[model samples]
Target: MGKVTGFLEFERLEEGYEPVEQRLKSYKEFVIGLTPAEAKIQGARCMDCGTPFCNNGCPVNNIIPDFNDLVYKQDWQNAITVLHSTNNFPEFTGRICPAPCEAACVINVNGDAVGIKSIEHAIIDKAWAEGWVQPQPAAVKTGKKVAIVGGGPAGLAAAQQLARAGHDVTVFEKNDKVGGLLRYGIPDFKMDKSHIDRRMAQLAAEGVVFRTNVVVGEWPQGSKVTNWAKEQVSAESLKAEFDAIVLTGGSEQSRDLPVPGRDLAGIHFAMELLPQQNRVNHGGQVENAISATGKHVIVIGGGDTGSDCVGTSNRHGALSVTQFEVMPQPPVEENRPLTWPYWPMKLRTSSSHEEGCVREFAISTKEFIGENGKVTGLKTVRVEFKDGKLVEVPGSEQDYKADLVLLAMGFVNPVASVLESFGVSKDARGNAKATTEAEGGYKTNVAKVFTAGDMRRGQSLVVWAIREGRQAARAVDEFLMGATSLPR
Candidate 1:
């Protein structure tokens, strides 16, 4: 606590955003971060509760109060250190994470919660601007070798930790660069790719080797690929080379709507559309890229991915945009007392929606209409919830014109070939069969193999991915050295 009554003295201040009209002209990050003074005041709002539920609330278990006090007292360097003690990348989480910590804040019980995410964002950004962030290479080599598949957050976090433990670590990415979904799935307008680039530099300086454009599984002819390895390497070869392997590949299989006109030319998955723009941003050529420019676009599935589609379409100069959600809209305000310290069901309007979007709830697409094998419009119907089940209304059907349709229904599981190649077992949900037990956590039935992240737990937040990566690294270290000092 900076002052005895700091929480009472200071009012909450949130970060500002660029005007929607101006931001819609281009695909770029628009949320402005807090300044030093503003962040300090926000830090003062932390209650320093006897039992900080915020720690348990955050998937990464960040030390909230300690860092808050540090920032309030002008010890920014130490604040960053405290933050890095638990979280591997606050910058990534600060921008994209949904901030479950705020929901768990004690101040949230009566008034506005402490802006923990904003303070974190400020601290890390300041550390980078001051050139305080550096690579901490291990002083001695353990002579242990580790191999990581997939360059997503989970794999990257595990690789970074393992490298710091003095193990010879190598990361394999099928694409031309690192960051699995973070690189391609997420639109750069929310988080620029430069964040990943800077972290890549740090990881490289810390002795982690990266090999991109090398698909681990079988690549069939005519398969979409950025680049290829001169000599293909099999799962058996990887097992032979490294002492241990961690399968942290994300869930890549997208759920599809098998309605009529499924083979229409203009209908595509959100992954197919989002990745093309990322490729263009990376200076790669994409022939006839999918654009909503001057076209009426309809995005099915109302989630983060769908919101991303909405943002991207607006930036592409779309004539009109509409989003569909199968479930009925939630209440604008949550029941605070009932949902305290837990995530509540409520309506969340993202900045992308503000840019320009017609959000429709309790709507179902009946069919896709096409002409000349190209999608032209969709037939839809309204529905209502009854006894916890949705029932379509008989006479509430409608039609809407659309040139582009993006399926953002979310992923099902990782590519089956990747897991099958390793002979790893899968859970009922099609994820890698593994537990988080400290004694035998992340260990696969196959010798010296482990799994984590979406590969192990299915689709989840980036913060949880980092937590799994750190824990999986600890488990791998213990398996190799009989014991380890890395945090679980």
Candidate 2:
């Protein structure tokens, strides 16, 4: 709204990345953010639509047009204030969120949408550089104590909100550090760990106590959530110690491909490979670390996790790399007229895909062929969609060499032991059975125990997790005090 016709005058200016060759040399962030002038031009492109569907498009409901105008006017401090009003962590979302807001832009109906993500990136970076971001500790104590299991985004968000509301909040993580998946599952190249470190400092200053290396469940905990906690604690002990307990653990169980030779030595989950590299990157000791060098790696699953594996493998100097998808390939571009405000189905070639990968769609893994208990190859078949079901074609069989097979087919549910410890009910999908409805929302069958995020809603985006945490905190506050002022 700054220039009135700014949308017509300026075209979209995408963020740039370092060359692939240069980036692969080390594990560092590569995206170069926009300058102040370039960011202002992009912010001016906001049309300030009457409806502002971008608000609905964004999971956190960030005030888009308001911040856009602030940025366009060079009011960077105010711009970041507006941006942080809704989103707890603009820096995290600015770097990795898929930017559904851009898809919901009104101008996108005809031409390009405003670069909302880049503008957000600019605002936050400028805010940090100017020391505008600071802690907001509560002035008085409510004297009520709350315990949060898991130190991921969801748990952290809930902790921050409750702490700011004057509640004594403590976060229990089983790992050597906090940040959940953000600390380990995510590579430093995509987003450095320093962002998490800064947020940890802010949360600490806000009076959130963090207890690491304290597992809440039994063995068989392997995901990032499990790694956050070191030793197990019983549910009875947590219930007796805290006024309220919120379970926000992630779905750490990786889905497996149980085919022939499934127990071979060279096959592993993406979680196992990704976390080792992260520990190494953090200067932690990781004996027998997984590597892709001098190997023909085949990653099963075509989602973001697989793409991450692809990037890591390329960096490891893998001899060859290929990615497999069970579904048919989507069109390069979506029919925008039909899919405009909603996320559309289209071929998404990620930065890792660009690094180097032989992407194959409509392929299904049949079996893992191995020699002397080590993976040597895999049998696959072509697949087609028929009557809303995947039908495998009998004669379209093939085989490929694979020195290492990575299963990145997504997670199933949280580890069962944690839920069992609390006797929490689970939905058909194996996630916690806590409705988001107004009455008893986030409240489990257990009296004082609550659930949110991936633990309650199954696997989802980080933004959605933050939303769940905030909402759950509100619910917990109301349950404890019979009234509350926390935002939903």
Candidate 3:
């Protein structure tokens, strides 16, 4: 509403990226955020739509119009204030979130959507540069203690909220550092690790305690979920010590392809290769680390994780990189008239895909072919939908050479052992069973225990994790004090 007809006058401008040639040389953030002027123009493009579908479209229900207006008026401080009100970590979402909000933008029905993510990026970066982001420690202690298991976005969000509500909050992270998947699963080229470290400092200053390298429950033996815990704390001890416990662990159990020769040495889960690269980037040594150097790499799955593998493999100087998806390729553009104000399915080309990748859709791997216990290639078949079921195409069998295979089909659920240790029940999908209602929501069948984020809702977006964390904090506060002032 800052400019009534501004939407008609402005065109969308996207954030820039460093040249692929220069960026592949190092593992650092390559995104060049929108300048203040460009952000203002982008903000001005926000139409004064009555419904503001973008707000509902965003997982955290951010006040999109308000922030857009603030940015349009050059009110940098208020823009960030509005942003942080809904999102605890805009930097993360601004960098990695797919911007479903933009898909639901009213302007996107016919024209390009306003660059909301870029504006958010500008707002948060400016806020930090101007020292608007600082510690907001609670003035009085509530005389209550809360334990948050997992230091990913959800756990961190809950810890910050509970700490600000005057409760003693401690976050237990199995890895040597916080930022569960963000630190290891996501490549540093998309978002630098410094963003997470900066937020950690702010949380610590706000009286949130972090216990890194500490697993609060048992880890399954020989599981490749990237545990770096140096110490262990029993679930019973947490229940005895803390007033409430929030399970916000990530969905770490990756879905596997059980075809023939899956036991090949060079074939690994995306997690196995990704986390090792991240550790190496952070100056930590990993023994026998998986590398793509001079190898023909095949990444299975077509999601963000697979795209990440593409980027990392390119950075590793792989001889060639190919990705596979069983599903048919989506249309290059969605029919906005039929899917307006909702997320629509369409072809998505990530920056990693733009770098260099041979994407094969409607293709399924039949078997992994190997030599001497090492992957050498894979047999595949083109698939087609027949009578509502996927069926292999006749005479479509083929083989492709590959030296390494990375399975990135996404995670299935949280580690079952941790839930078992807490005596928490799970949904049919293996995620912790919990509701999101206002009354007794987020509470598990077990006493004084709650679950949220990927642990409760299965693998999801960072924005959804933040939303669940904030709501779970409210639920816990209500359970501990019989009432809560925190927002749901």
Candidate 4:
């Protein structure tokens, strides 16, 4: 609950961004968080709804109302406490989460909702500045060892919880560092990697062991997932060494568009383009890294990955950037009454889109056109939906110039070979087969083995990964001790 009339008195204030010209020069974060006073004002806008859908809307079930009330009272210390109660990483969610909680806010029915994400961003930033964040090592050791494969949000969250529950935890990652996708896939301009480095320090202080550059299972050839492993550990070895094993290695198999001229030079998966830039930003060398400079870049796919490509291309001093989507363009605004308190399909323009982009919907890439061995253009076709299926329209074929093409079509599943090595069953969608029931959540068919995050669910949000990680940790605890006090 907040001030009774606060929602009516104040308009929603969004976090500011640095000027485009200045931001394009570097990979640092550009978001300007709200001041303490400003955050308090936004928090006061939380209406006292009997049923708080904002909690249900959030994957982590963050105590949104309590935190808002705390911020309104200028109790920044307790605000972080309430925030960290359900969610482990408010900094990550506050910066990158889409804020479905705001969509579910009661005031959003007919007016702008409280700036929940901005308030959260401000609270966490202030908490870190005030030296409030500290490691919480368990009081007693359980002597149960857990091997967590993958160091993304899911594995990190699970490792922290298991360690807090007094279990010895070791996180295995193939990359040279922790933070999985957060370490590589996401652009630094959106969120600096320093956030992850600080969290890793906290985890280490809490008695969690991190083993980077170590692969848990086999990595298939030509995969897009980053691998810097100098050593490999087998599933059998982990099962023999640890009391329990959790697979949080995300779904990394990038989806491909196989069509004519698919093998042309200057065409690549978005992963190949994104992770290299991230490495270069961190002082690593990318020998033959793909560059968008002075090139006509065409990004395929209209999801967040495509948007990332657009922003990256612009940052690389690209000549022009264009994005294509197979689906019809959504309306600029959604019909709230028809789809309130849930994620609705509507046009969403990310900050990357604001930098500059030409977006085309209801379009399909017919074929990649090439000159010599490199991509020169793309043959495209406009299409319409008929009986809920895509159908090409006659006389809509068009050719567009493209010097470089980046496919951001999203991921299909986790690499199957890795799952096969563990003998873990897979769902129809190719994700590891596991239930979320408290009785048997995250348990794979193999004994002493569990799965969570994108490895179990398909490619999903980082918030969802954190939620699964926390829940899986509880499940592992319950299995180990026959009862668990950790939050689900």
Residue-level lDDT tens digits of model 1 in 1-488:
66657889998898889999888877788999999999989888887588999999999999999999999998999999999999888889988999999999988887888999999999999999999889999999999999999899999999999999999999998888899888998889888999999999999999999998788866556666534344456999999999999999999889999999878988989998999898897788888799899999999999999999999999999999999999999999888899989987999999999989999999999999999999999999999988888999899999989999999999999887788889999999899999999998999989999999999999999999999999999999999999999997
Candidate 2 per-residue C-alpha lDDT over 1-488 given as tens digits, one digit per residue, 9 for 90 to 100: 68788888899999999999999898999999999999999988988578999999998899999999989999998898899888888888898888899999998887888999999998998999999999999998999999999899999999999999999999988789898888878888988999999999999999999998998856563555453445778888998999999999999889999888899999999999998899899889877889899999999999989999999999999999999999899999888899999887889998888888999999999999998989999999999988999999989999999999999999999878789898999999899889998788999999989999999988888888888998899999998889989877
Candidates 3 and 4 compared: the better one by lDDT is 3
Which of the two, 1 or 4, has more TM-score? 4
By summed lDDT, which 10 consecutive residues of candidate 2 come out lowest? 221-230
Per-candidate TM-score against the hidden true structure = 0.98, 0.97, 0.99, 0.99
User: With candidate 1 superimposed using the best TM-score fit, by how many Å does residue 58's alpha carbon deviate from the native?
Assistant: 0.4
- Which sections of candidate 4 miss by over 4 Å? 221-227
Clashing pairs in 3: none
Highest-scoring model, lDDT: 3
For model 4, residues 124-145, the per-residue Cα lDDT tens digits are: 9999999999999999999999
Q: Could you tell me which 10 consecutive residues in candidate 1 have the lowest summed lDDT?
A: 223-232
Pairs in steric clash, model 1? none
RMSD per candidate (Å) reads 1.3, 1.6, 1.0, 1.0
